[model samples]
Target: MSAIKDDAKIAVSVVVHACGRIDLLDRCLDALVRQQFHPRRYDIIVVDDEPNHNTLHLVAGWRTRTLDRGPRLSYVANPGPGGPPAALNRGWRVARAPIVAFTRDDVVPEPGWLAAGLAACDDRTEVVCGRVQTLIAPHPADAQPGAHALEAADFTSASCFLRKPVLERLGGFDERFDIRGSDADMYFRLLEHGIAIAQAPVALALHPVGPAPWGQSLLRVRHEEFDALLYKKHPALYRQKVEPSPAWDNYVVAGVLLLALVSALLGMDIMAALAFGAWLLLTARRCAHSLRGAAHTPSHVAEMVVTSALLPLLTVFWRLAGAVRYRVRFA
Candidate 1:
């Protein structure tokens, strides 16, 4: 732990949005505290969405232990509507520095991450997108079945920096994109506003893949709800940058499955059989495609098979739900 002069000016404020994952938050705080950047030049703020005894205790302990070690650390409980976007908004709003860096509680930044990100920022740069390296490995024995690794993009919420003025001007993240697509929405908005986004390849962070429960893929279909909202907000940008085309396979699967049920009710046995067969074939193909490069254990294979059968309906349902909720014509 290094000491900083009381009068030293802070240049960057790192904002980490956390939930109840105290373990991950602890590791993230440790990494931020050990940054190679000047202790007084940066500070760390953790915004807990679901504040609890454990989370408060962990942050309190860090504040006390780092009292004189520089790089001032603090905690803030998310005030209102619960979500990453809301928590992040609360964080940057209270940030003391002109530049605000965003990262997740699960991400462990490199020692030079802060310095690299700040170095890449210049007078014209409004945002800094950092490089994120995802650490993947086989699931442990005690890990839940069908667990998959997380992926990163060139511009993701996991690691990025933004100027406080730009954030305030843009009114921060849209709370409507509560689950997913909020980051992409914000990025697209930045582009629309002609805000400069500089890439900081040297500002690397390690995002370790964690375990997930069974049917996680199916559960994630709900993310499509937010995708529909994003599409409504930026149709052209969503098509160009987010998704060039819709998931035709999923549409086909959902359509045929619905047709099969309708045909059965009409007593058209032949049509019902044909539609059901098509659904099975499509689902099988999807399952095999999803298994590519994935774990081949019996439990994992079974999980994929079950999720593949249900994902089409679930995905379409959520997408439609979002479209209706957001008043969009997106399919």
Candidate 2:
């Protein structure tokens, strides 16, 4: 990677979407300040997405520590709590650079991360995505507790750089995505417009594993609605990249459990026993599969076990809800 020469121009705008988790956001800000790129060669824009958010104070605390003639750091509050896509678009709107890069508040980028991504950008490149390695926290209750190997990934906003023109032409991220899969949708649109999406393997970022509350995973069911939206917008590409499979497992589990409950109500003890036993077997298999590469503390194991059992049902319910909402016939 090439180091930024003295008197380099600020050509890159690194935008991070921040909500809560002041600690994580602070870490991300620290990493950005430490980037090898000359401070003047890049700027850091953090958009606070939380309603009545106080992240500006956090940014204020770090403001005085700005590098001597390094990248300019600023914070902006989102118009309202419209989610990541909104915060991203808001930041990019005010970005002064030709290249607009994005990462989450929880990510800690390597010193060379920006340089690697910048190197990948050229006249023909419209977007560049870097690699992200998951750093599992030692805590058992961490929501995303696991190790991640570096690998090629589809377009992800988690560690991505996009040309300013490309973003303007493509209309930025669709706010309908709300939170999840917004990057994929944007990249898909980019492909449709014949824009080039490049990969920068050397631009590495670390995603630390952290705990999520019990209902958080279940909330992802809303992605089904976005999935339906994606399919509606890009049928052929969606089919190629993410279609042809239904959540049959969810239906199976739901059906078996319903039958078991009905049988028990009717005094069909043998039938209920067999049905419940089958459900248990399926749940056990799911638990084992999920626990395979995860940190296996007692708390983690128990959390996985309970969530696994609920996942299929929740998944099916959400898919159906999404299908109804989007009228896409997803499942």
Candidate 3:
């Protein structure tokens, strides 16, 4: 790429939705400072969802430091009670770029980030998305690639971008979803509105995913319930797109735990011992998977273990929250 081409490329803005985790946000911002894309081609906008004044000051400091270099950096505070979607919409409104990219405050984009997404765009494309890779210690030999192929979709929220026009039409992400399932919730709504979504393999972000926060699992289960709403809206597509989960696995886990509880109470030592051992083995594998690699201090290990134990509950809660919050608004 010529220096002039790099300097003249269309501007792209990254809208980050951040709350209390200033440390993670800092890392994300730090990565932006090092983007291989020309400094003139993009800007970073942060929406501090924290109600405190300190966040605003921090954002100001970042901008002041960045101004000495290139592309303008800006920050906006959400007017409503803080939530991810709400914060994102707030940032989207003031974005000055023809393309607006959505990324969590915790994601670090790859070097070719700007060129990758901009190259993927064309007059006919409405939205584009990149891949995400988890940052973990002793990373697995096999990991799922997050960069997805582009296609006509309802909507996309996972490390993605939208044309200014489509974003204006969809009114940004559905702010009603506080946490869980909000991405897919908006994605489904976008499909309903006839939006285009394409995936770019070259654009990528490194995002962290590990252990769950204490008892936050129920919200995840409740969140998944919104998937049913999609079914209600497009029965055939939902059926064709999503597969039936292995319900038998859950049943076995539940039954084994119940049997172990009954056996122990009845002093059936052999059966209780075997069932308890089986349960521990299964849980251990999950724990192992979650804790594999990067640097983990003793405290990190404790947190990861706790999160692993709590994730199943948290995921269930998340999906359930989705189902309850978006009860059959299908028209």
On TM-score, the leading prediction is 1
Name the best candidate (by lDDT).
1
What local distance difference test score does each model get?
0.84, 0.80, 0.66
Query: Of 2 and 3, which scores higher on TM-score?
Result: 2
Off by over 4 Å in 3: 1-10, 139-158, 178-180, 190-194, 209-222, 228-237, 242-331
lDDT value for candidate 1? 0.84
lDDT of 1 at 105: 90
Give lDDT tens digits, candidate 3, residues 137-198: 34322121112211222334447888777778878766656443366656666667777767
Candidate 1, residues 72-128: lDDT per residue as tens digits?
788899867999999999999989888999998989999999999999889989899
User: After superposing candidate 1, which stretches have Cα over 4 Å from the reference?
Assistant: 1-8, 138-152
Backbone clashes for every candidate come to 0, 4, 39
- Best-to-worst ranking by lDDT: 1, 2, 3
| Superior by lDDT: candidate 2 or candidate 3 | 2
Alpha carbon deviation, residue 203, candidate 3 (Å): 1.1
Better of 1 and 2 by TM-score: 1
